[model samples]
Target: MSDLPIVGAALSLAQFIEMRDVMFGHDRDLELQDFHNPQTLDSDYTALVEQSKKALDGYGGRHGIHGPFWDLPLATWDPMIREVIHDRMFKALGVCEALGSTHMVVHSPYLEWDHRNIMHYPNAREGIFERFQTTMAPVVKRAEEVGTTLVLENIGDIDPHFRVELAASLGSSALQISVDTGHAHYAHGACGAPPVDYFIKAASDALQHVHLQDADGYADRHWALGEGTIRWQAVFRAIGQLTSNPRLIIEVYGDQSVERSMAFLQNTGLAQ
Candidate 1:
């Protein structure tokens, strides 16, 4: 197998310690999941950040965290709810600043329903964009000051170009695009969206990060590589063509699954 481009794993601090052999000397996404929890962020955030810093000592590869995303939609029209999102995002950026991380992954606000009914509402698309811009204006500014790029990840988004346009419209260096392979595959398989590779191509130079996983197109499986039916070779081919050099992170379940996923990529000469 050809030596693949450097790849990374998305795991917690404990998982990284346990799978150090498989994950060491590679890019990583520390799944600081507690940051997404309002209670944890409100209570034990400093302690958690300190513990993460201590745990990550001696590791040397490009790294980041899965930023706060649960219930934090970017397109809220309600001013009060938008403020809550802004606070949560800033807190997530606080973790980035503390960890010396350069990238933070956030969910795309576009949903499947949005894709289907956007035209019917006429002004809905622009409204979504305007609201998102309002919610993220200050947050993006903070991200710029902290030197962290907010990589917008695909969730239920079916249209690939929507995010590309949104990022381009914002015109901020702090904002870019991210693709979750399984999510794209699901959109293609279940919905009528294009395949995973299409998402990569659409993002093009704006793409900055990726979450690698396998899925059957029916759901967000987050399974180990080769466990599901994603066209990984095609996905990698598209990634190979990108000049952006986005972080390639295996975001699966267990340590064994992470290792197995790595093995599949290695054996196929797609990635290492």
Candidate 2:
């Protein structure tokens, strides 16, 4: 209702079409894993792309995709393992190009536990950042070649500063920061990181994407907005003040009510 390019997360093509009007008119955060089976790549995902294009014909809002990142650590020390991630990422990009998606979200590999493992070493933070950048270098280059911004999302990040620093260090226009509100809240309490608002401010300059979900401090509930403990008003205000316009996607559980979440945002004046 705010007409600010809000998106709904549809894990599959069927789910996307189920909210076709809401998506085409507004925007859609398409999740690739829903349609393409990662375990088997023998089948082409082109059909899914065709379906998506058909569903989003004449769409006015920008489109985004959440690339596959599970078990694929971009910053892993092993070169062979990193190659697997790079290959999978490129496959996702192929889908991105087919769907004309402008942005793709990739999970960060900097978990608090891993950071602690290097705490005693010299320049530990810098070293970890370097590994992440190194692993993502090829992905960033591919993104630039295809005219898409690789939005690095915070998942297991210990500090927001390091996350921001990584984006700045890339120095490529193809890279940007993506904040996951639920992850931020969970990390703040579980991993001893700064508050969620602090994470927003830290990454404001480079923030171009967001997975806007609500979660309790205890777990990543993926609850509908206003159903979790997050203070929606403050989060919206912080985002509103950013110089760049970020793509806000409503990512909730399969059974969660997106309509109720949208209504809450409208009724509270957080969104128009």
TM-score of each: 0.95, 0.91
- State the TM-score for model 1: 0.95
134-219: candidate 1 lDDT, tens digit per residue: 88889899999999999999999899999888877778999999999999999999999999999999999899888999999999
lDDT (Cα, 0-100) at 271 in candidate 1: 79
The count of residue-pair clashes in candidate 1 stands at: 0
Candidate 2's C-alpha runs over 4 A off are: 1-11, 27-37, 40-42
For model 2, residues 52-158, the per-residue Cα lDDT tens digits are 78876777667767777778876687889888888788888887787788888888877877667767878777777788888888889999888888888899776
